[model samples]
Target: MKKALTTIFCCILLISMLSIVEASSHRRDIYDYKGSSTGFAREKVNYSLFNAENFTGTRMDLTGNSSADSFIGKFFGTFFNWIIGSTSQSYLSFNGTDLDFNETFLNGTIDTRAIAVNATMKLYVDAQDIVFNDSLKSYTDAQDIVFNNSLKSYLDAQDITFNDSLKAYSDITFVNITGDTMTGDLIVPNLTATNNITITNNLDIGGNMTLGEKITFAFGEVIDNIVNGVIQITGDLLVTGNVNATKFFGTYNWTEDSPLLSFDDTTLSFDYAGLNSSYDSRYLNLTGTNANQNLNVSPFNITANEFFGDINATFVKIALGSGSPTIDQMQEYLDNTGSSGFFTGGIISDGGSGTIDITAGQGFIRTTADDNAPLLSFNWSAQTGVAVTDNTTQYVFVDDTGTISLNSNEFLEAQDNIILGLATDEDGTIESVFNLGVRLEESIGQAGRFIRRIHSVSRDVRRGGLVFGETGTRNITLTAGHLWWGRTEY
Candidate 1:
C-alpha cells in the first residue's frame, strides 16, 4: 500500500511537465525542396565539429541538426545542447552562434516540379467528355439534314435561311449526294448561298433552276468553253459579260468573241460546225436601215435554212388576221413568205448540193422527195483538203505491264473482237500490237457468227483455233487450282 501511494505522486509531476511542452511551438525543419531539375533529390552527408576541419565520424539526423557522435556535458559558455534523456528523443539546437553547415545538410536540393501548377493540372478540349473549347462549339451529330433521290423535285438544295439581324451567311451547311436526281425550281435570289456546296465527282442534275435576279458567278463557277444553253428572252436584256449560248432568240448586240451568235454591224451570224476549226457563219441582213425593209441573204455558203438543235421547229410565226388566202397568195408566201406567211424551213436537207449561183439576192427553197420515192441510193462525199492514208482495220489495243489474272470460274465475254496480247516490246506501237493475240469476228453466214483467230506465243502449246457461233460465254477452267490455257487442240 505504501509503494502504490508513492507511484501516484510521481505520475502527477510527469503530467504537469507534459502540459508545458504541448503549449509551445517549435521551428519544424521542413524539407522545402527548391530545385529538383530531374526527380527526387535526397543526398546523405556527415556531421563534424567546427574547429577541426574533420568529421566526428557521425552522420546528421533527418532534421539536419542532431549528430550521432554528439559530445556529452559540452557547453560553449551558456550555449548547451539538448538535455540527455532516455525516454523521448529531442534535437539539440545552439543559439547566438552561426552553425557550421559546411557538409551536414543532406537533401539540400528542392523539388521545384512538385509544387509546379502545370505538372499537377490538366487541360480540357472536348465538351461531351467534360472538356470545352474557348468559345465552346455546340455541334451535335444528330443527322438533322437528309439526302436522297426524293429531294429531286423538291429543290431542297436551296435550304438556306435569312437572318435579318446579322445580314450574312450563317448556319452554313454542306450536303453531298450520290446518284441523286434533282428536278424542281432552285431559286437562289442571293447568290452568296452557293459558298457552302461541294461535289466530289459527277454531279448530274436533271432539271432547271432560275437564278432569277441579283445572282452572279465567280470565275470557275461556269466554264466558258463548255457552257451550253438556249437563251430566250422577250424583254430588254442586259449582259455585263460574254454570253455562250447554242441559240439566242432576242435582238442583242454581240462582239467578235461571242460564239454561235454574233453581229458584224448589220448581219446576224450563227456558227456552223462549232466543234471544228473550219467553220462558217450563215447570216441574213436587211438592205436598208429605214422602214422600207428589203431582206437579203447576201452571205452564201449558207447551206440550209434550218438550225441544228431545233427538231421540226417553226422559227417565226405570222398572224393571218383570221382570214383565208387564194392559191396565188399561198404560192407567193410559200416561195418568199412575202408579207403574209411566216417561214417554214422546208423539209429537212438530205445533204444535197445544188447551186443557184445568184449573187447578192433573195434565197429560194425547193422541197422534194429523195430518189423519186422508192430507192436504195448510195451517197458519198470524200473529205476534201485533208490528206488521206491507206485505211487499216481498227483494233483496240489494251496494254498492261502485269498479268491480268482472272477467276477461272468467270467468263470473259467480248462484243466485237477481243485481242489478248503482250502489247509488244515497244509499249504502244500499233505495228507491234497484233503480234500476239486471239481475235473473234462475226461470220457472214448464220451457222456461226463468232470466228476465232489465235496466234501462238509458245511452241509447246496448241496456239490457234476457231469458234463458230453467236457471241457466247466460255470460262477458263481450273484443272488443279490454277488457270488452264489453250483449250483447243489446234
Candidate 2:
C-alpha cells in the first residue's frame, strides 16, 4: 500500500508539470506564431492575448492585421521610444514615456500613442509660439528642428548654426544684418551694400549688371546700383559708372606694353582748351577740330598750318587754304636722288589775219629734254607780221601795214622758194614788176654784191614770145660778163 501511494503522488506531479507546459505552449503560439483564422475556430481561440494590454514581451506575427501592427507599429516604436525616452521628458515620450512614432521608420499608418518611449519633458505644441529664440547665445550644442514652409521669421530673428559637413537652405531670405565678414556666395533677390562698406581684399563678383541712366562713384564709395554688378580688374579699382572719381591719386602701371583706344566713326574731334599737354618721342599725336577746319601748329615762334617730319631731322611745311599752296621752309627737303630741275621761259603763237600779241612770259609753250639738258630753246620776244590777200588766180595783193624791221645782228635765212605778184590789165592775169632797187647775191662774200640789173623791155610776135605784149621799160647797168637780149616781130 505504501509504494502505490508514493507512485500515485509522482504521477500527479508529472501530470501537473504537463499542464504547465501546455499552457506555456499556447501562450507562445499567441505571442510568436501566426496562422490563418480558418485553421482554428474563432470562438474557441483567445484573442485578448494579442492585445497591447496582455502582450508583455517581444511579439512577432506573420499574418493578419495583427502582424502588421506588430512589425511596423510596435517594433520600431518600442525601439526608438526606449532610446529617446531614456533622456528626459523634455521631448515627448512615446506611448506614455518620452518617445513618439516617426512615420519615416515604417511604411504604414501606426498608432503612435500605442508606442512608448522613456523621456522626461512634456511635449507641447503651440500654433503662435516663437520657433526660434534670438537671445539664445550658444549654438554649439543645439539640436536640429525642421519646419514646413519658410523660415523667414527665424532667419530674421537670429543667426543660425550649421554643424553638419553640408547644409543647404533653398529659397531663403534674410534681412537687416550687421556683420563684418561673410564667406561664401551671397545671393540676394535685391541687395544693396550701401554707405561706408570697406573691403580691404579682393571682391569677386561673377555676373553682369544692367544700368538705368548713369551710375556715379564718389567720396571713397564703390556703389553698384544695378543688378549682378561685376567688376573684375587685376590691379586697382575698376569702376563701371558714367562718372568715376579717384580720391587718392597714384601712378597707374600697365602690364601690357601696347595700349590702344579705338573709335568706330569716320571722324573724331578734340577740344584742348584748358588741359596741359606734352608729347613723347615714341608717340604720335593727331588732332582734328571740325569737319573742314585746318590744323595749325606753332612751334619755336614759327607758325605753320601743317608739319610732316621723320626720324632723320627731315621736315616739310605745307600751307593749306583756299588759294595757292606755299612752302614756307624746308630742311633737307630735296636731295640727290637721281632727280632733275626744269626752268621754262618763252612765248609763241600762230600769226594769221588776227592781231596776236605774245608777251615775254605769257604763252602756251613747254620745254623738255632726254638727258636732262635743254634740246630746243625758243624766244619769240620780237613780233613779225606779214599780210597777203588773194586778188586773182595769178595775182595777190600784198599790204605791208607795219614797219618791216629785223634785228641788225640777226639775219633771216630762207631755204625754200619765194614768189611775188604784180598788177596786170587782164582780169585774172599777173606780171612780174622789175625795179632798179631789186638785187641778188651769189655767195656769202657777195652778200651785199648786186649780180643782175634791169635795162630795157621788148616783144616778139612771130615766135609768140610777146603774145601778151609788154608796155613798161626801164634802164639798168649790168656787169661785164652779163648779156642783154631783145625780141621783135617778124
Candidate 3:
C-alpha cells in the first residue's frame, strides 16, 4: 500500500510541472527570421534592430545599418566610405560616385608623390612643411597662391612672368624681397601717375645715383658750411653772376689800399688797407660783453642833413644858409640879437650905437658921437693949465702926477653945506659969492684967490684969503688972526 501511494504522488508532481511549462511565453533571439515562426538563422540583424527605439545605445555603432541621422551614424556614413572606398585611385568613391567633403583636415603629412589633387576652388598648403621637388605647372586661369614662409626656387635661372594688367594683384601685403637684383619696371597705375620709392630708414647706396630733377627736403640747420635740410652741401659755393643778399658775412680785402668791409650780427666793420702805409681807419671791434662804440674815421666825406658827436677838424668851412658871412656881418648879427656887451681896455659900450670916445687924453666916456663935449677930462701924459671954453669945458681935471684941477667958465663955486665941519654957519648968508663965505674970484692982477670968513679959536670972526701969488709956497693971509691963525704974505 505505501509504494503505490508514493507512485501516485510522483505522478501528480509531474503533471503539475508539465502544466506550468505549457502556460509560460516563448522568447525571440537575434538570429530569428522575420515573417515566419520557423525559419533559418541569419548572420546579421535587420535594419530595424538598430533603430533608436529598439536598442539602448551607449557609444558608437560602426557596424549598424541605420540611417545617417544620429551623430555616430553621420560620422560613420561620411568618413568610413571615404576611407574604405579607394585602394589605388585618384579620388575617393562613395556609393559608386565621387566623394566630396565640405572641409578636410589632414593632421599628418600628405605623401604628394603617391597622390595628387586637382582642386577647383583653393588648395591651402603650409609652405613650412611641404616642399616641391619638381616643377609646378602654371595655371592658365588666375589663382591666388599664398606662401606662409619663403617661396624659394632651387633653380638657378627661375623666372616669374606676370601679365600686363596684373589686375587681381592689387593688394599683396607684407612681401619682403631680399634678393639684390630686381630687374623690371615697377609701375603704380593711379589717378596721379607717379612712381615713388619710399624708405623709412637710411638708404646707403654703394654706387652713384643720377636724378633728372631737383631734390626737396624739410627745413633744417647748418654747421661749418655744411647745410642741413631744405638744401645741404658740404663744400664751397661759387656763383658766376651777381649775387643780391640782405647781408654779406665775409671780408673784402682786394687791393693794397682798398678798404676792407665785413659784417656780423651786431656790427659792420670797415678797415684801412695796407701795412706799409699808416692805416688811419679804425673799425669797431665788438665782443659778447664789452663793445667799443666810438667810431673813429681819419678822412670822411659825407653830405648829410644832421651831424652828431664831437668833431675835431683842422679846417672847417660852413655855408650859413647860402654863402659865407663876413666877420662884420656876424658882429651885426650879434648886435641885433643883443648878445654883444663886454669890457675891453677898461671901457664898456653898447655893441651898436654906444661907443667909447676919448675926450682930451686916454680917458674915455660912452658917447654916441666923437664930437660930444666931455664932462670930465683926464690927462695921463701931460698937464695943461688952460681954462676950458664953454662948450668944451672941463668941470674937473685929473692928471697922472696926482694933480686935480677944477675949471669952469662960471664962478669956481664952493659951499659949506655940511654943518658938521669945524666952522659953524651963522645964518643963510652964503646965498651968493659976494657974501662972507667960501668963494673964488678972478682978477687981472692976481692969479686966483680963495676968500672965506673963518672963526678963531676964541670964537671971533676973522677974514681969511688964499692968495695965488706969483712964486711963493705960502699964500694964505689972515687980516685979524688969533694965536691959532697965521698970516703969511708973499
Candidate 4:
C-alpha cells in the first residue's frame, strides 16, 4: 500500500508541474475579450511527440498504430497496464497531449448523445436558449425544487400545498365573488355582532325572538299599524303620540258576587270580594261603551235628598231623590239602599255634641258594647234641629252607655219639637228620650229584649202631635183621648 501511494503521489506531482508549465507559456493574449465567455481562465499546451503541422483531421489525431509495444517493452509492462501513452485511432501517443475536438461550437449547436459535466465545471446559459424538453435537475440551492430520495408521497401526480401568504379564503360557505366586492348574504342559525347591524331590506324570522334590553322601532311612527298580542311588556312602555285602539281591557277579573276590582301589591292579584255583608250586592258588569254598572259596595253615599221605597217590596222598588241628605233622611236612605241606618240597626255616634249634627256628609256608628247591652246614641255640637236647652233638655242625649239620652245646653220654654227621629217600634224597645213628660208608664225591659226611646216632649197633648205607643195605650194621656197621633215615618 505504501509503495502504491508513493507512486500515485509522484504521478500527481508530475501532472501538476506539467499543467503549470503549459498554462504560463501559452494563451498570454487569450483574455482580451472577457465578454465572450462566462469563465475567466484558459489553457495552452506544448507537445513533444505531437505535430499539429502535419496532423490531417478536424482535431490533431494520433497515427493509427505504433509506440505502445515500445513503451510496454521499456517498462516491463508495469507502465503498459498503467496506460501512460499509446497511439491508437484517437488516443495519446508516447508523448501525452491535451486531446481537443477541432470542431468549433461558436455560432453552432452541440450534438451529443449525453452530457456529464465535470462537477467543478458549469454549463452557463447566458442570454441564450437551453432547450430542455424534460426536467433539468441537480440544483443544490434548496430554493429550486427537487424530489426526496426516500420520502413517500401519498399522491405522486398531485402534491400541492399553500402557506399563509397566498391563500385567498377561510372558513366560509358559498361565497359570492363579484370582482372582489364584499357585498354578500350570510344565512346562519344564529348571529351575533359586537357593533350595530343595519338591514337595508326585509329580515324575516320564523321563530320566537328574545332581546336583552330595549328594542326600539324607527324614530317616528315606525311601529305603526301594530296590532295587540298576548305578549306584553312588563316595564314602562312609552308612546308619545296618541294611541288609538278598538278596545282596551284592564288586567283584572271581576266576578258577579263582588264585581268591583281591587288588586294586591305584591302578588299582583285582583281582589273581587265583598267589602262587608251589610249591603247585599246586585252585580251588573260588562266591557264596552255605554256600559251600565251596578256592582257597588251599596252605601258609597252621595249625600242624599230623599229616598223612597215600597214597604212590602222595599229594596225592589226605590228612588234616589237627588237633594241634600240628613240624618233625618238616613232612615229613608237605609230603607231604599238596604243600609243599616240610624233608626234601625247600627249605632249612631254624634261625637260629643248632645244633638248629632247630621248636616255633614260623614258620620260614624260605634258598636263597642256587650252583645246584650246594645245601645244606640246620637251626639252633636252646635246643631240646629235638636236644640240644646240646658240640663233639663240635656236629657236629649245619652248618658249611660246602655241608656237612651237626649242632651241639650240651655233652658227653654220647653217647646222643642221632634226634629230627626220618627215613630219606630223596633221590638217596642225604643222610647222618645227628648220628651218632657208629666205622666209616664212602662216597665223597664230586660237587656236584649226591649229598649225604648221615650218621647215625653212638652207639648199640648190634646192637639195630638208625634206619639208612639200601641192604640191600646199603656198610659192614657189626660190631655187627649186620641191614640197614636204621630205620623209613623219609619
lDDT tens digits by residue: candidate 4, 294-338: 434334432325533332222233344458443234444443333
Predicted structure 1, TM vs. truth: 0.16
Pairs that collide in candidate 3 are none
Residues 1-490, candidate 1, lDDT per residue (tens digit)? 9999899989988898787565333222223333676955545344223333233322224434544355533334223444434432222233435333323222222345544544455322232344443224333223224333445434455433212212232213223221242222343434445445643345445566455333224432332222244333333456789978665453555566656667855578666544233342233332343324433323323244543342211223334554563322333333343111111111111111210110111111122222122111111122211111122222222112111221112123131112222211222222222222322122123212222223234333423343334344664432222222434342
User: Each model's TM-score?
Assistant: 0.16, 0.19, 0.18, 0.20
C-alpha lDDT of candidate 3 relative to the true structure: 0.35
C-alpha local distance difference test of each model: 0.32, 0.34, 0.35, 0.36
Model 3: number of clashes?
Answer: 0
Off by over 4 Å in 4: 1-185, 208-325, 328-490
Off by over 4 Å in 1: 1-244, 251-490
- For every candidate in turn, the CA RMSD to the true structure comes to 35.0, 25.9, 32.3, 28.0
Candidate 2 lDDT, 1-490, residue by residue in tens: 9999999999999999999877766554442343676663333334444223244555332233343243434555544334454444443345533345444434322345334321212232232234433324234224223331235455545444421112334213332222424444445556465355555445456566444423444454444444455442224465457645553233543333332322224332332332233432233344553324433433323334864543122334444567664433332222211122112221223234422222231111113222322222122334433222223222211111211221112122111111122222222222222111111223333432222212133322233232233344854443323223332113
> In model 2, how large is the Cα lDDT of residue 136?
43
* Candidate with maximal lDDT: 4
